[model samples]
Target chain A: MSGAAAFWRKYGVLFKSDWAIMMAYRSETLIWMVGAFVQPLVSLAVWVSLSGEGSIAGYTASDYVLYFTAVLVVDRLTRAWDVYELDRDIREGTFSAKLLRPFHPIHWSINGNIVYKTFFAMLMIPSWLLLAMFFPAMRIPVDMGTIGLVILAIALSSAIRFVIGYQFGLLAFWSNRATAMYALYEGIHMFLSGRIAPLSMFPDWVADAARVLPFYFTVAFPVDLLTGRLADEPETVWIGFAGQAGWLLLLALSLRFIWRNGLKRYGAAGG
Target chain B: MIHVEGLTKIYRVHVRQPGFVASLRSLFHREYREVAAVDGINFDIPEGQIVGFLGPNGAGKTTTMKLLTGLLHPTSGRIEVGGFVPFRQQNAFKKRVSLVMGQKSQLIWDIPASETFLIHKEIYEIPAASFKERIDYFTEMLDLSLIIDKPVRQLSLGERMKCELVAALLHRPDIVFLDEPTIGLDVNMQEALRRFIQSYNRDYKATILLTSHYMADVSALCERVLVINDGKLIYDGAISKLIDRFSPMKRITLVLGAKIDTSVVEAAVRNGGGRVVAYDYPQLEVEGPREEVTGLSAKLLTELPVIDLTIEDPSLESVIGLAYSEGAAGESRR
Candidate 1:
């Protein structure tokens, strides 16, 4: 087989092992799932209460439900905690094992992310279906074209988040408080990604700013695309895709730059 | 094969002092010290040779091992292991060598050893047939048939170490670096491991570099030993020569079948210009110049009612201790 084929075969094995380990942590998964679900659920409740009998900023109670549920799904699909995992590996000297291997250490995190997100999605989709069953207006149309676009957006969004998280993790090579930095990033992401409310409910300037920033692309843009916010505006939807691609490219470069420097620093420090 | 010259590693450690003032002051201005962990050590091992690296704690033995294994890049100097610069970590170089740190493990904690072995099989790209054959051979050799399938957390320390050796050697690397492979093991386990290492060396002709505080580990497997102390190599020669140079006196033990008077044994010992290092009841130990061992034994056999008298060199432990003290004294004088 060719080199790429061999690499993917190895990746398949890594996925199998990682999936097994994730399955072993059933209680932890449930807790994380609850944390994931509760945030969107609370957001939905707050937005619905604010809407009361009429639409708030063009988002009716049912539209708010659809948006937050999309937020829940998109957020879970794109979440990356590679920062914590990489931080622990670097701190505990376990990364030495990875360095000794022939392959790059990032492959392990990549495989883990795929396995974990797939498992979380498998668990969350049923609950989402159950929620939509009781709430008729919250249901999304089963349109194949829209589904394809949403999947593409979600893929790009996950890559962006993963690279950003990994770059933050590389900070551990120089600073002990990289996780604090990641928390700060998460705080900004929360405000900008429409986790509090739909961007349409925000002031005009804030909504415009969110559209231009990568955090919005990571969470809100994908949710909006799936919830039909971009359905009627073909040009705007294409612009959204361009923005996602732009940020993904930029973040991928930053990941490479930070990783190169981080490995140099690590080698210099004799880790 | 391994070649190293003037290999050095210096670690920059931040300095701090107690008290709130020092801590606050250190936020803006910090102090750092460059400590030389390995200072210009040099050695070369031809293919298929088992060379022992002997040193005390914090004596740069582990540092040298790390340098050789590419775990740490050297601050200065040169090192080539299996014909590749270790720090570059080229796949071809990594494929030919393995490192096993007794205190650290590469096996996954929550999984069975077989799972880890399979992972290694993929990483090393071992063929399925050879992988199975090697696993079966190693398991049978290490008596790990019962424990290979068990999670590593459940195995005893000895059993875990045995599995570790198997994991490391399964790829059949041409070079192996073992740092204290027998640490925390019982005598029987140590002996078993030593025997296995010797067998592997013989069968594969794999160049072995081992570091251990257990002198038995060195003496049993390494004919040539490199002694390092305080970040420098003090001696590198045959183990027998090391003993000969550091410990000039031979030891003779006597187990008398009948009760022999202490004075009678002492007189006979002194006749051969030997000193009685220890004497209690029927047991006696004599220390003397090497040349006199034959005559001393002769006199003891004839003069004393001895049932068993064995002549041997000083233990490797005492010889190594003497070598270290002598190196320290030399350092002071210099």
Candidate 2:
């Protein structure tokens, strides 16, 4: 088989298997999905209550809802949990089984990310559409060309996050602090990636830091695109995509380096 | 085929000493020592052979298996499996080998064993007919037809092990490394697995390297064995030769027709170049060199009031124990 054809064949089976497992714990999955809404909804509510009839940073109460709504969908679609999964697998020695397979182990993590995101997307989009029917704030203006760009940005953002998370997971070969370290990074990312608040609401210095670093591109840029906030600024949209692309490339190379070196240090620690 | 030359794996491990003070000190500064898990071991296995890797726990049986399977990079020395350096882990090399560790499971716990089989099929790129053929063959051979669809978490230990074997062998790998494959199994299950392994080896001509604490597993399936202890190969050859090299005695048990003096029996056994294993009013047991069993037994029967007598070869456990003790002795000497 050709390379792409072989990849699809393997990915298809992996996706199918992961889908079954996801379905098996669907109640727990639904709970996690519902629980995720609390943060974005809470932030939206706080901002709305504070705005009242005014804006904190040239914004209205409804705009806060729209921004948080966009944040919800984009974060869900682009989020990855590979860091936790990889940490546990490596720490517990299940990773050795994965490494022994004829396929590269990274493909398994990729397939898992695809499966979960696909699951989240299937649920979140319809819910978003339903919410839009009732709440004008949730509605996004239909624009085919701009929607396509948002998708491309979200896909790139997901790739960046996945690579970063996986590299953090690879640190388990040396120390048990991999997950804790990633958690620290994630705490920073929560603020800078615009999950907790839009970058525009932050102070100028923090806003610039979020933009210049990889954090803004991971979630906030995709949210901005989805909310049509960047449609007028074509140059900024391109820069956002460029930021995502550059970070993804660098992180992927680093992941390759980490994976190669990590295998040498793999103790295969358990029976 | 597998080739290992002076293959050594040294692990630098944190010395986690006992007590709160040690733990506190370790937080700031930890001591470490490099221990050779596989100390310059050398061996070669031909294709289509079943070879037993014998060793006590922490003696490097599992470490060598991991090194051969490319799960760990050896600290030093060389290893080649199927004309490829195992640590390089080429896809072609991985495709040709399978490892089954009794303590670690590869099957997904939440899903049916059949699901894992399907996943393995795709990863291995096995053709449909070949995949189906092997699955059916392994299922029938392992008696997994009924349990294959059950979630692995729901299966008994033996059933799960059978499913694990099926998951590992569905691709028909040319080299199989089995580490304690029959561990935690009942006698009947162990027998079944041993038979399945023997049949698999015979039919596919796959090179098998296996380790088990059960001596029967070695004696029944493996014609040759490599005895390793203290990270070194002390004996490598046929099982019988291992017995002769280490345990040179044949156990002889004799029933006494009446009570006998303990000193007299001890002297007689000593005279035959044997040690009195146990002595009671009604029975006498001793072990001596195999060649002396006949002469010694005859003399016992003629001199004492012997009711009945029987002789048996030393158990493989005793032979392997001696091999390990000798290795420890050599380690201490060095």
Candidate 3:
């Protein structure tokens, strides 16, 4: 078989195994999703109350609802817990099995997250639709071209965030404070990635920084693409795709760099 | 199938004293020292040979195993397993080798051992028919039919280890590294695992390198043993030869029916060219060279009111323990 086919074949088995594990902890998963939903839910409430049925900084109540719901779903789908997992694995020697595998450990981490997010989405989509029925503002603005571009953007966004989180997770090879490093990264990401507020609501400099930096490309840009923030200008939406692609390329390169160096350190540590 | 020449690994460790003041002081100027975990060890094993690596804790056995399996890189020298440089970690090289650490588990703890087997099947690309056949065979051989479907966390240590070995060998790797594969197992469990390992060697002709402090594991399975201490290879030869070289004394035990004077028993043993190593009225123990055991036993039988007597060679535990201390002392002096 070709290498690509072999990769997918292996991935299918890995995904199935992880899906079983997720299913066994279905209740715990629901509880965690409840916590995850609170962020976007509160953001929507605050924006709606402040807007008073009008527009706040070019965002209508309806726009705020759509943007925050999209953010919540996208964030859930792209979440990475590898920083803590890697830290614990390295310290406890659980990483030995992963390192001994013929494939890179990141593939396993990625596969596990894919299974978890797919399960979470399967559980959450119906609730999202029910909420949309109760509140018309929560309904998504869908189009064929927009859906195609948004799908590409979400895929790239997931890849970019996964690589970034994985690269930070590799810090555990050198120091015990890898989780702290990830938290610091997430602190910066929250403000710039529009996890706290939409990029349009940020100060002009912060918004521009989010655009030039990779943070907005991961969360806000994809959320905006889905909400038709770039609706009128098809060219701008395409440009956003190009920006996300560029960041994905950069993060992918860094992931490789971090992984090669991290393995050397990990091997030296005798795990 | 496996060869090593001057293989070495040195770990750079940071040293720190344990106080808040010392910790603060270390932040600016840290002290580092290089400890050689595997120091220039050399050995070779042809295909189908199961060589036991014997050592005390903190010796280089595990480090050498890790280096051979490409889990850790060597600082110097060369290692070739199945004609491939192990540290390169090439896909073909990896697929041909396997490692099993008794203290570490590769199975998914919350899932059945069979789940891990399926994952390995995908990773190794084992044929579907062969995977089924092997699973059935291993389940019967290891008596895992009842436990293979249970979650790993729910299994006993020995049962989990049984599952671990099956998972590792499912791919039929040509080069196997087993580090203390029966560390905490019962005697029966250890024997079962040893039989499986021996059978694997016989059938596949795979080069097997095993490390265990348990002397029974080495004596039962390996013909040639590698004794390492202080990160150096001290003795590499047959197990019997090691016993002969390091321990030549034989022990004899007697069960006296009536209480005998300790002095008389000691005197009788001394005159027979054996010393009373232990004595308690009705029981006496003597140690002597192999050549003197027969003469001494006969003399003790005739001279003392001995009810029954038995003789034995020195245990492997003593011979190996002596080898490690003597070898490590010698290596340090050099």
Poorest stretch of ten by lDDT in candidate 2 chain B: B325-334
For candidate 2, give the lDDT of residue B216.
83
Candidate 2: tens digits of C-alpha lDDT, residues A17-91: 999999999999989888888889999999999999988886689989999999888888888889898999998
lDDT of 3 by residue, B1-334 (tens): 9989999999888898999999999999999999999999888899889999887777788888888987777889999999998767787887888999998899999999999999998888888999999998898889998999998999999999999998899998988999999989999999999999988888888889998867788888999888877798888888887877678899999999878888888899999999989898777899999888899999999989888899976655577678776653454222
* TM-score of every prediction relative to native: 0.87, 0.90, 0.90
Deviation (Å) of B73 in candidate 1: 2.2
Candidate 3, residue A263: the lDDT equals 68
DockQ of each: 0.34, 0.68, 0.50
Model 2: lDDT to the true structure: 0.89
Q: List the candidates ranked by DockQ, beginning with the highest.
A: 2, 3, 1
Native-to-model Cα distance after best TM-score fit, residue B232 in candidate 3, in Å: 1.2
Model 3 vs. true fold: TM: 0.90
- iRMSD in angstroms, per model: 2.5, 0.7, 1.9
lDDT tens readout by residue for model 2, B48-97? 99999886678888999999999999999999998889889899998899
**Docking class for candidate 1:** acceptable
What residue runs in model 3 are displaced by over 4 Å at the alpha carbon?
A1-4, A53-55, A60-62, A268-271, B249-321, B324-334
Q: Write the per-residue lDDT of candidate 3 for residues A1-271, one digit (tens) a residue.
A: 6778777889999998898888888899889878988978888899889998689889888788788889998888877888889888876667878777777788899898888878877877788889999989888787777878777787788888888888777888788888998999898998899988888888999999988998888888788878877788778777788888898888888888887777666643332
Give model 3's docking category: medium
Identify the superior model by lDDT, candidate 1 or candidate 2. 2
In candidate 3, which residue pairs clash? none
Model 2 lDDT, residue B33, Cα: 94
What is the per-candidate TM-score for chain B?
A: 0.82, 0.82, 0.86
